[model samples]
Target: MSGIEPVEHMARISGGIVNWRKLLLIAAVTLVSILYIPDAEQLWSAWLRQEEFSHGPLMFLVALYLLWRRRVLLDYPDRRGTILGVGAILLAVFVYALSIKAGIQNTRHLGFLLLIFGLFLTFGGVTYARFVFPSLILLPFVVPPPSFLNSNLSYGLQLFSSDLSVSWLRWVGVTVFQDGNIIDLGTLRLQVAEACSGLRYLYPMVGLGVLTAMLFDIPLWKRGLFVGIAAGVAIIMNSVRIFLTGLFVEITDMGISEGFFHLFEGWVFFLFSFVVTLGLCWITLKRSERKSLGRGVMSVPEPTGREPAPMALVPVTVALILCILFLPLATYLRHLEPSIPARASFNSFPLKINGMIAEEDLLPGVEQEILQLSDYFLGHYRTGEGPPITLFAGYYEQQSAGKTPHSPRVCIPSGGWKIEDLQTISLPRGDTTVPINRVLIGKGDQKLLVYYWFQQRGTFIANEYMAKFNLLWGGLTSSRTDGALIRLSLPLRSEQEIPEAEKRLAGFTQEVFRILPAYVPD
Candidate 1:
């Protein structure tokens, strides 16, 4: 009788403490997430490392907390969503299969989220997904913003930030000249770089706004208004940050706004923006006179009637079988479909082309990473009297993931150079005209003329978006991801006009064009 009493007590404790079916569901989800562990770790690393995605790590904890709070809704026992669960799981597996070869981390994140959705459906059918849907929708903080959107958004934002900052400078009675993204404050030149474009802040603000609304459990209309206002707030704050830095530099020594100090300023302003966001949330909540949805680390969600057993067996079994089969299938699809296309090798590039002499130079460590190279040649060319023009060619036999050429639009401004102007120009190459992106970057009185273009598998792309789309198209069709970035820059002497610079660059291109094809294979 004592043994039977203990057995009954143990059974009772198990039932009241934690459901056995919930344990099974957790175990199944864990097993599935293990397959996507590497991808999750990648996002975590990006969130922790990159300044742009600094707000990313917060989402993981937020998602867990959200699930924990709404734990009551997770219990529903209907096999109705099993087919949909299997479909969602299969969608995840398929996306992984497709995106793995290309190293698209965004797609991997999407796949992992889909896997979670599948688990939710398997456990609680459509009921849980419907009830706790905000958690799924409020998760853009972790995923990196898509590059396709960056092209237009970054350009527009950079221009707006620069123009707005210049206006603020004028309002402060500072003599400032505006040219595209460059702001000449007579004392110090500020280049509103792409990083300063406020996309980073915009992404996080929207993400935080959504989470804030969820936490505050505010009205639907008010929540949307908050998010929309948050975007404008990000832009205004970023612009204000730019103006403040310039004003401080003009008033004090520019040294205080250079290097580490500049980075610190960026951090402080972003923190300020976050605080302001919280303040807005607080004020809105106060006006409504509503208490927070819940408090404490282990608060239980609002009750949602009786708990039911989860239907997990069939979906979990099918998902595992499909995942096992996908591994070998992915290996075959990514490799056997495309052969390595032939291209010109950089081995035989000449040091002396016509009368010009080329002196080779080594790339810096960070620069080497940007130019992910199968082969590369960096040279400074001079005739005898005039200034030397640098030529850098980076060739990639394959560009998988983000191992493509880094654009100067972002890198130049980071290096403390302000872009005076940038445009696309056509350089006459033999019977044809090759279009190239031309830019003028400066700091104080110093200026440089730069021309660059992407020599893709067989096409020359001046536009960054064009290059990206072509790469994507090629990767999808033939799996040929070979490309190269050819860049040339000339430092202007104390006395050199636009015409002289253009004439000199055009003349050099004519001489060097003959030797380029042999190195940058077709």
Candidate 2:
């Protein structure tokens, strides 16, 4: 910690030769990861298919390269953080086991991160771990978020882009009406689809920001500022481009902004935002240097301490064994799955639940693939001389492999409906109370009362994260990860129409909740 320390003392130990124990530990870790190759391969497939997540694999490689570049700059800490390290290892094993049983890939990916972090503490201790903190932090971004977060974040970005684009268009003498994620420009209608949400550029920009921060000696707050600005810049630039897209359509009145123009515009904005982030980083570095000079504390250099020590045999062995032990558990859970029996088809679902018989026709744009469900029923339910309610049930045979329900909260905004109010509501379903998520979505003067809930393993869940967690738990305990999303959407015309709409949905859900297990296979 002193300036008197020699810079030469911190030189790479023996010119980058790793000791036997550490070398073997790395090999063992690699072997363990190989055992989980299926999961990694699936992720690679996702990276290839989903543009928003395309940068994920590169994040892992970049983190590895960072750690490898500074391998000799790290050293074992004074204190091992024995208790914390052991606790982390145990937590990792428990989570990895549960994830394996439950088919929750995110939790499994989380376990992989914790497992390595725990090893660092057990082997090199906390001080040694700090040397590679930036690399460690980037690991989470490698795993694409759960479906719920993905949908929500994308929806939010769409709304932001639409609002800004709409405002900008209106300011520039173009007649425009903003409808949720869509921009109506009199001559052209642009639906701010997921591509325009700017997530594709935002994620990679943040990754670059993190890498930039790691490459510099900037303060943590400044590093965080760079990351935040990267996200902000991506959104702002996307908004600008969306406005331009609308303007181009308004002026040219041609569909020239679809294929090549789209890609060209995206590249222009992405490069602009990335350059802005880099410029901000350069500014921060210049300021830090000036501040250091003004404080007169830039006189000497000090080594962080000893280079990395030889890996301890006992801790490394324990970590490796724990990792290897969980491999078979993952394999077993992969093979062990819930039973799906032949059940009454949703096609045969009664038109009459609580005296609301199914209507004869389907709503236009009622697409099932959007929900990504194995089986789904979309029908309008109505009683004689009363307002009709839309009943939808999306069933997933297995709620793993990223085949999970997409929350309506994420999809509504893109469909040109803004959620005016959101709250959890409960209804009495015989002996036990059933909880439901309620939302008031509006577009212009039209309003809708929407009630939805996750029916997982015969249990009703309102919270998104808790539903996913319980799904994983169900797979582990009962080999059942099957779930269904039940939604009741009704139009609200008059101010007094809400009470009736609520009553209809409540009465309907009370009856539907009892019979959902038959079709969803809990």
Candidate 3:
């Protein structure tokens, strides 16, 4: 009876400890959630708006399920929180605060993942962290890739898909001419736009690959190979889709290019790719493991006994303190208004420059709405019989996640123009030289030379990454995020005309650079 009383008393104490730890966890989660409300809103908006990230919600649900499956690890006797989690927590808070101030949602999303990792480490200890690492990593799959990466990847895939589809068509004896990303077939024309870039399939498939890797207990190399195979299958299957579209259009009407059939075919090929990738991966596993594929992947044994040691209070308390210290600062910085300097509106921009007469033009209403520019100027200037040089300057009082200068690298391709050559070249401005992006774009033998640069504050930046960095720096240091994209373009008649076109553009750019400061406000 004496032994029984002691055992019963220990049981009551253990129950009390468990309840206290659970309360601490709840408090921590609620605090973290409140701290990240803005980021959560942005993520939700992205998932709703972009098709590529539409899988975000599903990935998130899968992550929760994976974590739930491993919940038994939380009761293991050896669990002990690590102090290293405090460092991770601090780093996450710094990143969250900085990204919010910079108005970069991607990094904020990263910070969210880091915070989750810190919390898990603080409460569950190293062993439990490793047990749930796969699930933790899956959270990143829910965030969209950065815009710069998305643009370049989509363009590459578009070009590759178009090239391969054209080759296949020619091999099958279909009369088709490949012009940049366009497929020309006498009576019909098909432009491989960004939507057909195969990313729509690739992103989701990669997420599925991650989930599959989590579900399978295969060799590490085989798991990696399976993911690589899944990506390859997506690209190859997309090419096949394009080839089939061309073939169908050749045999039938142009109706197959769009509408219900195109969408249905895309779904069909994606499923096919999934099945093929899965079968290929299955063949790599041992026979015994193959038979038990999904059954035991998450089969964690029941915990033998709960540990009576109290949850690590030091790390959790430190993490909550850090969050409390940073939340108000992040919120304040995120809502801080930039100091936009007084500047002449683009409406007052000079029309005539360098002995040239200029005609003003306005972008279509839809384009203007899409661009979300605060102010802009578009002009075509001509000197006598020389070819006209077009100038476009789009300015924004402040840049946010969705509203900023659209990179010509992204915009030109969408207009059925393929970027054949791109580089940075120095253009003499006053006593110094400024770097500008030079692009040679073409469509069906017609080529255009474009020079563009981002004008942020008083600096001219040609590289997108540097421009983004400067934007963040400016927002943090000077409370100024106003910027503009200045572009100059000229048409070319033939390959031999490029040098002459360059000389003309250089002269026109010199004139425009002289007057740009007034309108763009440095």
Candidate 4:
């Protein structure tokens, strides 16, 4: 009877430990889901809509598998959470709240990662955190790059690929003339559009490279090299694909550049690039050690029967408490509508300003829909002589992700205009100088000088980062996110005409800036 009693006592203790651990884990997951489900839904929608982020679901599954594989690390002796973990949790919650208010999806995604990292560190300590780092790091790849970044990268890649394709075609005795991203194959003209810019291949291949590096028992430098090789392979293969398309068009027909065949060719080349990159990485490994590629990668000895350490409870509880405290605040901010101040409409803007004869222009309905602006002004003003000065201002009563003003720096390149020189210059305005971005852009023989700035409340911002910071700050303090992008452009016929164009733009800017307060509001 005494022997049976001791055995029963031990069984009860083990059962208690198991139940407590299970409860803690369940609570942690529930809180995280409650906080981040909206973000997760946004990511899921992006994965479904965007080809570039199509690898998100697969990466997520792989991260889970990795975490499961490294589960034994959590049971290591003396495992305890740290103060740094607590700080991380606090920082994550704050960032998440701020990003929510600012309507920035990329930062929200980052906040999600920080939350996961903080939770793991708080519950499992440094050893376990290190073991699971690879899994957690895979999350950033799931979200597509912000639209502005994606646009700039796509435009640069298009021009580069077009130039390479043109050079390759000419080398092969096929006459081709290149203009920006356009490949003139004499009889057939092919434009290297955004779809063929190779971002679809680059992003996924880089993610795969990281995954491959994590799985392989390789040196850190070698892992970096492998990722670089993957990026290079993707870019080179995309260029080659363009070259092939041009060749086929010259020799065969235009059908090779469109429909099913074009897509099939891209898939085939991407696969080939992957194989080649992997082969290169394998060859770079020492012959004697190549057989043991994944031998010790994230492998740890299985832990024997273990109980949750009491020390871990402090950080875990603190993290949960912080999250719980933050949840209500986050919810309130998410639902808080920004104060949209009443203002004069852009339609009331005058046609003539500063003695320049003006003609009003309306953006196409498609463009208006894409921009999502509350109000806008597009005016072409001309003096008695010289080229006209074009003025545009787009106003948003409330800015959110995907519904913000597009920067001309990005928009110009997309329209096939290469920015020759760009700098921030001060325009003298009354007592103090107002900072503005000046850009010299060219497409073929046409050149234009542009001046643009962001007007937020009463502040004139020249930098995009500063503008975003102000947006976040304003949303928090004043509950106001109203802003407008004001731009002025003048054409230059010759290099000598640059001075005159700049002078014209500066004069026109003063007149527009004076009346902008009425339409855009202070």
CA shift at 80, candidate 3, in angstroms? 6.0
Provide the clash count, candidate 1: 1
Model 3, span 220-313: residue lDDT tens = 7877887888889889888888888888888888775555347644667678889988887787778876776664335566655554455677
By TM-score rank, best first, the candidates go 4, 3, 2, 1
Worst 10 residues of 2 by lDDT: 293-302
lDDT of 2 by residue, 370-465 (tens): 456787788888877777888888888777755888777777877888789999988887786878899998888899999999887668888888
Question: Pairs clashing in candidate 2?
Answer: 351-357, 351-358
Q: How close is candidate 3 to the true structure, as a TM-score?
A: 0.89
Candidate 1, which segments miss by more than 4 Å at Cα?
Answer: 1-24, 77-82, 130-133, 146-159, 178-183, 189-203, 219-221, 255-268, 280-317, 324-347, 351-392, 406-453, 459-466, 473-480, 486-518
The digit string of per-residue lDDT tens for model 4 on 431-507 reads 88889999999988999999999999988999887887888788767878899999988898987999877777888
TM-scores for all candidates: the values are: 0.70, 0.86, 0.89, 0.90
Error of 3 at 88 (Å): 1.3
Winning model by TM-score? 4
Ten contiguous residues minimizing lDDT sum, candidate 1: 292-301
Candidate 1 local Cα displacement, residue 488, angstroms: 7.6
